[model samples]
Every structure is written in structure tokens, then in C-alpha cells.
Target: MLAHSFMSDEKKQNSPRPLILAVEDHDDNLVLMSYALESLGCRFICQKDSTNTVLVAKEYQPDLILLDILLPTISGIDVVRYLQQDALTCNIPVVAVTALASREDKERILKAGFNAYLSKPYMIEELETVIRRLLCGKIDSTSGFELCKE
Candidate 1:
């Protein structure tokens, strides 16, 4: 289902839902994320290949992005860097979702330009919390959420 076309024009103008760009190579992961985003009343564009992630993101103009750190050919960190450099997509928040759970790995991903990080096998609630925190533009140190430096 293409969630982007699901919303009507009136609904968009009245109460628009946040659009998400989910870049993950795993089909199962894409399905799971799609379900989660749908359940949360958010629209999403999913890309299984990282090769064209930046292009797709620019076209979709998502409010946020859920990026996987490990992808075929291109790493998620590189994708993040590309997005950060592109004026069209630079402002969109990107959260890394990957299996790299080590402290150093997390730090490295953050340093690469991701706005937030979510380790693999993350809880649905945790994902929801992170998504909400980012979409709301509430990146406070006291809010128990870690945000990347500008």
C-alpha cells in the first residue's frame, strides 16, 4: 500500500500526518516498520536499496527518516552524510536503526550525522518514542533523549 496516496487533499490541509522515509534492505524489517508507522497514523515511503536513498528522500520530502546502518553497496552512514550535505534533505531528521549496538558504534553513527539512533531488535514503544520526540522537535537533554550536535 502506498501510504503517500492514502491521504486526501482536504485531510492534508486540515490535519496532515507526518511522512516518513524508511530505508532498510530487509523486506521483513520494511513490513514491520510499515505496520508500525501505519498504526501510528503516519505516512511512509520505504526504500529497500540504499543506492537511491538520497534521491528518494528528496523526492518524498519526508518529515523524518528511519535509516539502517548496514546496507548493500552503500552504508547508512554515507547516506546520512549525503542527506546532510543536500540542502533539500538536510533538515529532515534521520534516526539510525541498526544492529550496531556497541557504545562506540553508536557514537560513530551519531558523529556521522544521524539525528538519533535506534539499535536493532528495538521495542515498538521505543521506536514510537524516538519518532515522536524527533517529529515534535523536542530534543532536550533533560528529556532523556540524545540528539546529534548541529
Candidate 2:
């Protein structure tokens, strides 16, 4: 199921608010994430799993993606790989939001293709900071997208 955060067409057209694609399966986590994204003034689309992640990313072209490494069918590492290989969604930043907090796990996830990593139980401020940094000049300008490309 894809749940979209409500944003009026007029507001979306006139404002520079970033659109996010959040791929997380846990219901509690999704609720918390939804609140945080909305509080940070972002419009987001939520996917419960990685089943249609690539397709959604291509169609929505979100400014950022918050992905859970442990998903139902496919892992988030594999999902990021797919996104990187696609021209349409390649430059979009993807962040790993997972419980794997070990140093080796972080290194492996980043190596796999995620632009950023946020361990589970992250503060809302951390989420805000990551979103701001990634979305800044990301939509129109290509300044911060070099990380995504690599």
C-alpha cells in the first residue's frame, strides 16, 4: 500500500517543499516517520515494502528516499542498487533507516549504494538535518547530487 502525505496541488506547485519516498514496513515506525516528515514540512509517499520501490521512484521522482534495509521481499541494499542503475531515479538520494548500527553494517550499506545512513531510534532532529542537507539545491541545482551519483 502506498500512503501519500496530503499536500494541496496549489501548495505543491507554488512551494519548494521536498517530496520524499519512505519505504518502511513496521506500522509504528511508519507513523513516527510520517509525523516527523510532516513536521519538517515535507510531502511524502510511504511504501510498506520494496515490491514496487523502483517503479514508484521512477514515477514520483522524489527528492529523497528513506529506506529500511530489512524489508519483506527485497532488501533495501538491493533496492538502492536498482535505483542507482536507473537513469530516471539514479540521482535521487536514498538514506538507509535501519537497526543495523554496527560500524561494519554502516560501511556495507553505504557501499551498496545508499547516500546516507540513519540507525534506528534516530532523533527527529537527525532526520531533519539529513533531509535539509540532501534536499538543499537538489531539485533544481545538482550541487549535492554528486554523492548520489557515486
Candidate 3:
């Protein structure tokens, strides 16, 4: 339940950056994600487990959520269900960051309410791409993302 914030110096000097909520049970994974999110100029809160995730999400109302599927107390899929049921945090985009890399796993996770999926062992570039798209992209009539008009 350790929460920390990071921002790139340039982003700090400019407009406010996106705030992200990352839920991961592993300390090492949390550290790695913190660095990656920092490099992307995002302010993030990291939760070590899913026990208080719904409360935390409601409190913060971050722009996006990075959730690990296999979490302690409550699984990430279940967490998404809880988040979707709550109006305060329902619209925030959720990305599944998990080791489950199979096609079936990806399909299932997306069907479970995650807006995006990123397999574990992902590169920083991939993480950056996901963050950028979800934060900057626009939701279309079909409930899918599209490049925002400039």
C-alpha cells in the first residue's frame, strides 16, 4: 500500500501530467513500473495488493490504472469488476499488465473489463505507447479509441 509520485522535470515545469494508479503485488514489479511511468512523465500511485484498491481508486480517481492480473486478496479481474461498478472510478481506462501472454488470456482479460492488455516482460517503449494512447486518444461512438482531432 505504499504510494509514491514521480514526474519528469520537463512535465513538471509544463502542464499537469496524467496521474496513473498501478496495482501490483510484487515489490520488484512495482519498482520497475515506477521507473517506467516516471520516464513517461506520469504521476502514479502504486498499491502492493488489491485489498484496498477500490477505495484507493475512488480516492485518487487517476486518469488510468495499470493492474496486474494475479494479485493477492482480490484478483485483478475482480478488481476491474469492482471498479466498473463504482461510478467514481468506472470511466478511467484500465490496462492489464500480466504474465498471461496467451491469445486466450488476452481475450479473456479484455472481456473482463480491461481496456487494454500488456504482457509482462514488456519493453519501456511498449508501456509508453499504451500510456500515450489511452491518455491522449479519444473514445469513439463504438466505445473504441481513435486518434484525437488536433
Report the number of the highest-lDDT candidate.
2
TM-score of each: 0.81, 0.82, 0.81
lDDT of 1 by residue, 59-122 (tens): 7778899999998768999999999999999999999999999999999999999999999898
lDDT (C-alpha, whole model) for all candidates: 0.79, 0.81, 0.79
Task: For candidate 3, write residues 55-107 as lDDT tens digits.
Answer: 88887678899999997678999999999999998999999999999999999
Which segments of model 1 are wrong by more than 4 Å?
1-15, 137-150
- How well is each residue in 1-150 modelled by candidate 2, as lDDT tens digits? 544343323333535778888889898888888887766666788888688889888987788999999997899999999999999999999999999999999999999988899999998768877877888753433323333357
Ranking by TM-score: 2, 1, 3
Candidate 1 Cα deviation (angstroms), residue 76: 0.4
Give Cα distance to truth, residue 137, candidate 1, Å: 7.6
TM-score, model 3 to reference = 0.81
For model 2, the local distance difference test gives 0.81
- Model 1 residue 35 CA deviation in Å: 1.0
Taking all chains together, the TM-score of candidate 1 against the true structure is 0.81
Which candidate number has the best TM-score? 2
